[model samples]
Target: MNHYRKIGNILESAMKMVLLTGITGFLGGHLAVALLRAGYKVRGSLRTPSRRDATAQAIEAAGGNISNLEFVELDLTKDAGWNEACTGVDYLMHAASPFVTSMPKDKATLINPAVEGTQRALSTARNAGVTRVVLTSSIAAIVPGRGKAGPPHLDASDWSDPDGHVNAYVESKIRAEKRAWDILQPGTTTTELAVINPGFIVGPLLDSDPGTSGALFQRFFRGEVPMAPQLYLHSVDVRDLANMHVAALTAPAASGTRTIASFGAYSIMDMAECLKKAFPAYREKMPKFQAPDWLIRLYALVDADVRANVRELGYNPSLDEAPGRALLGRPPIPITDGYIATAQSLIERNLV
Candidate 1:
């Protein structure tokens, strides 16, 4: 089937219900909006029931129809509602996972929740007979842990080595994604799985909260980061990322595969330039020069968070964009637009 027709058929099937985890998050909120707008009934999971109304408001503000949206209290660390939430769900969008820029003091704090959560979501979805599952993983799971001298270009075959110089967050994503694959091995269950390894995701926020990716721009705008680190990221807009997630649910080629969602690698200085061009008023605040490796090392000595990601300095890798282009059926949103939208959202919400 053609791309539009396939998506049209899925959208027209109003009976199809999607159980979406992490509906309150940056990507989750976008996914909920996309799923709802596409005519799927969404039952979003949340750790705190009180956030449901606010999350719904955020989704609604982002142009999602909440009439078909509902909420269930679920926790990654506990098994309180896994089976119950999975029951009667046609597809599972497992997007809920711990994410943080700063490394926790203990690695287990992040790793345990991420690994165990994927285990719970996949196991319960299989038991509940969900047709397919689309997991939201990160390029962090694909591109890190390899030394700075690793391959210039990375694809689905690449995996971040947990034993390498990866931090807690990268290790958690690697382990969690691995656990997901381990659970859904062929012959083990009828449920098919597709994983999306997206690069740095940035776009307009649905709410006032500046998520981990949004915080990148937040720091930049607020002059918290005076010097741009010698870092580069393969980037994507959250809207495209959300659509890619939904498309994976029905894309035949997506089954049993990891599709990358990134435009290309862009450096910290590149982002600063983009922002400076878009918002000339903020040009004075933008980092004029990239920090040298030795300066970054010295800064890390004073900041534990910087120390955690010290290994990432000067590391850059090209990501294969063919899978993303095929799945998206178009080029991903321009990286400059993604950067500008993020900054604009933060400014509009008074988050900066």
Candidate 2:
């Protein structure tokens, strides 16, 4: 009878468990569903417990298994719940970093949480004996410091200069990712670290909250943006980015490194063209004319959002995603598909 009970316990605990941070956010919500669909028990950490029911309903509506999903209240700025959150967790995916386009009145509002949150989370996860941590970084950490005069291509080998002339969002990502590596690089922690540096993420959202990237598309389709800027950015499907996070869990080759997950850089006009070709309804709404550099600079003087893009205006960024793609065992979802899905989801939700 004792032996049978032991066997029963073994069978019950066959599935692995993953502790995911920022599970209420757009990417985090998608990651939770994907992990559940792949048969892992997901214990998601959010700042507020009130969002659990809504998040669960959204995941369920998107065809995720809610039976194995659970939530705990945790915030990036505070250190109280991390130990409890990491307890008994097999994998840790830290996806909760503050992202914004406008430079805040105080930069530490973004920088402190991101760097300290990663440090706190990683330290706690290591203490709890979590095996691996996959941090959701961004291309912002890699793309800066590449002046227009420099090489056209960048890969995981590069790092963004935190001291460079970049907005608070880019600086926060740079500092946060560096802090993560500083913890893991010098054998400071037993836990392995893998980072996913995704570009402008655009794809179908499970909930009405289409993230910052989706907000850009929303403006485009709503005709809020009359003239597209000369900025170009590498776009990745949210689903593909989530997949890379899951794959990083056990991929031995993925340990102690960063992966750039993107289809390629598409200019505003280029993405608008893609939208126009895919959805006839957006043909007129999407900006066909690219704003000249001088006009963009003048607009930036008054618009905080466009001011953020001043550094990259007319600069096309090219990235090497082959390494990241190989790790996922699949190619990235096409750029056009990402845009179409993003638009369709927004339209369905009446956000556009």
Candidate 3:
């Protein structure tokens, strides 16, 4: 199929309208800002309309033009306003999914909302005849459950084994992404699908609230984490991830493709070292040593977050950044910059 031609047609249209779900979220807020800055009319989805003003203010504070931004109430678990929200939309950016750091007793708490939400968004977009949909997936969908013996070099083609010994979040992401592809399969719908699978995202926060990624730095700054875990994180700046989502809208090559938006991988201690150098004031609070694997296991016994991700200890895999770099048309933003930005944002917002 000539994907380029489809995108060309989209560009020819004037002032496309994009329906962005999860606009109140961390990555979603960035995506909304990027979309608005790119001159698209964005109707941001919110579960509660009360957040409209704050969300708009946050986007505006982030240097986005919110003059063209509007809000609609929609919930991932409910179908009340989906059709009305999707009507006349040119594109759909589905970024609303349940995210939790700890493992849930009932996996369905995360899995059901994620998978069902994808279904609601994509199916509604198709019915509305939306041209293309940009879905926010995660590297979690591609990287986990491959086992220690799996391929060392991971890319878009990699799929996490949902049935394997993976966490609920990983399983949810894997299932949700698969459901998206299943719903938007070739020759089935006019809405072309493009996915952005990002890694551990970190960057400046648009609001005082620090989402999951930002909370990591919040904990670090508050001296909550005394020892760094032995986990390696594939990092990406939220700003770059947001830009990639905007780029995917008309990048014909992105259609029907999963783009890995990661700069590189760094260990937890590595991040600590970077932060220590950047913020000397927090030097005493920052983790000075990597926790032993055995100690981490024991800590997991009482820490739900640690227990949920205990399997990730020493589980770093190589990632191919060529596809993401090609999409960006340049090198990714430095991880160091992201680290600093996150720290500064936390301090400025008094989140720490």
Give the number of the best model, judged by lDDT: 1
lDDT of 2 by residue, 1-352 (tens): 6456435434543588999999998899889977876668999997888888999999999878999999998988887888888878988999999887567889999899899999999888878888889999999998865555556778899888889877888999999999888887747778899899998888898889878888888888888778887878888888888878877887778898899988767888888888888888778888969989899899889888677668777666578878888876766788788888998998899998
Model 2: residues >4 Å from true position, as ranges?
A: 1-14
lDDT of 1 at 186: 61
Better of 1 and 2 by lDDT: 1
Q: What's model 1's lDDT at 2?
A: 62
Stretches of model 1 off by over 4 angstroms after superposition? 1-7
| TM accuracy, model 2 | 0.93
How many angstroms is residue 257 displaced in model 2 relative to the true structure, after the best TM-score fit? 0.7
Residue 241 miss distance in model 1 (angstroms) = 0.3
Clashing pairs in 3: none
RMSD to the true structure for each prediction, in A, is: 1.6, 5.1, 3.2
lDDT of 3 at 124: 91
lDDT of 2 at 338: 84
Candidates 1 and 3 compared: the better one by TM-score is 1
For each candidate, how many residue pairs have backbone atoms clashing (under 3 Å)? Answer: 0, 0, 0
